[model samples]
Target: MNARKTWTRTLGTATAAGALAWAVVAAGQPSAAPTSEPVAETGPGYAIEDYNYPGADRILAEQGIVLKRGDGHIVLADCLSEENLLRFLARGRADVCFKVTADEGFLTLEIPSVHGVRTDDSVNTHLAMTAEDDRVEYDIPAKTWEGVGESVDGREHVLVEIRVTK
Candidate 1:
C-alpha cells in the first residue's frame, strides 16, 4: 500500500509539471487572433498628364489669341521690350512680337487677321497661316519683312503658328 501511494503521487506530480511547462510556452507565443484587417489587393495605377503651358489662358483672354503648348523656346514679347524681335502686323490691331530665347524654338498660336510678319536676322523662321480652304506656309528670310494674307493674295488669312530655328 505504501509503494502504491508513492507511485500515484509521483504520477500526479509529473502530470502537473508537464501541464505547467505547456502553459508557459503558450503564454510566450503570439496570439492566433488577427489584430488588423488584411490589406486589399490593388490593380495597376495610372499616369498623370502634365502638358499644359503656363500663363497661356491669361494670354488668350487678354490678347484675343489662343497660345497653345510649346517647347519653351518661343515666348510673347513686349513690342517695346527689345529692338530685335519677330513682329506681326494684324488688321485692326496693334503689332505683336515674339522673343526667341533659345537657339531653336517652336510656338503654336492663333493670331486672327494677320497681314504680314517681320523676321529677325538671327534665326531662320517659318510661318503658317490658314485661309478659307487653304493652308499656306511661308519661309521668312532672315532679318527681312514678308507679306501674308490679303497683302500677298486676295484672300485674307489668319496666322496660325510659327517655328524658328537658330
Candidate 2:
C-alpha cells in the first residue's frame, strides 16, 4: 500500500511540474493572431555627416565672409582676441584672422580681394585664390607675412581655401 501511494504521489508531482512548464511556455508565446500591416520606423533614423559650416549664414551676413565648409580644426578668431593668430588682409574689408587648433587644418571660404596673409608662429599655410576664372595658390611660411592674391598680380582675387600644417 505504501509503495502504491508513493507511485501515485510521484506521478501527480511530475504531471503538475509538466503542466506548470507548459503554462510558462505558453504564456511566453504570442496568440495565433495574423498581422496585416508592416512595421514602420519609430525613432530618429540616422545621422549623416554633411560637413557644412555651422553659423555660415550668420557669419556671412555679419562679417561679409562666405564660410562654406571645413574639417573643424581651424576657426575664425578675433584679431585682438589672442596672440599668434593667422591674419588676412583684403581690399575694402577689415582684417580677418583665424585660430588653428590642430596639427593640420583646412577651411574653404570666400574672402574677396584678399591680397596678403600673415601666418602664425606654429604652422605653414597654403592658400588658394581665384581671379576671373584663373586660380592661384600660395605657400606661406610660419611667422611671416607674405603678399598673396591681388598683391602678387595686381588683379582682384578672392581667397577660396586655406590649408595649414604644423
Question: Candidate 1: where are CA atoms >4 Å away?
Answer: 1-51
Q: What tens digits encode model 1's per-residue C-alpha lDDT throughout 75-100? A: 88898999789999989889999888
- TM-scores of all candidate predictions against the true structure: 0.69, 0.75
Give one digit per residue, the lDDT tens place, for model 2 in 16-43.
9999999999999989898565344655
TM-score of model 1 vs. true structure: 0.69
Task: Specify the highest-TM-score model's number.
Answer: 2
The residue pairs found clashing in candidate 1 are: 121-143
In model 2, the Cα lDDT at residue 80 comes to 95
True-vs-predicted CA distance for residue 36, candidate 1, Å: 16
Instruction: List per-prediction Cα lDDT, in the order shown.
Output: 0.84, 0.92
lDDT of 2 at 136: 95
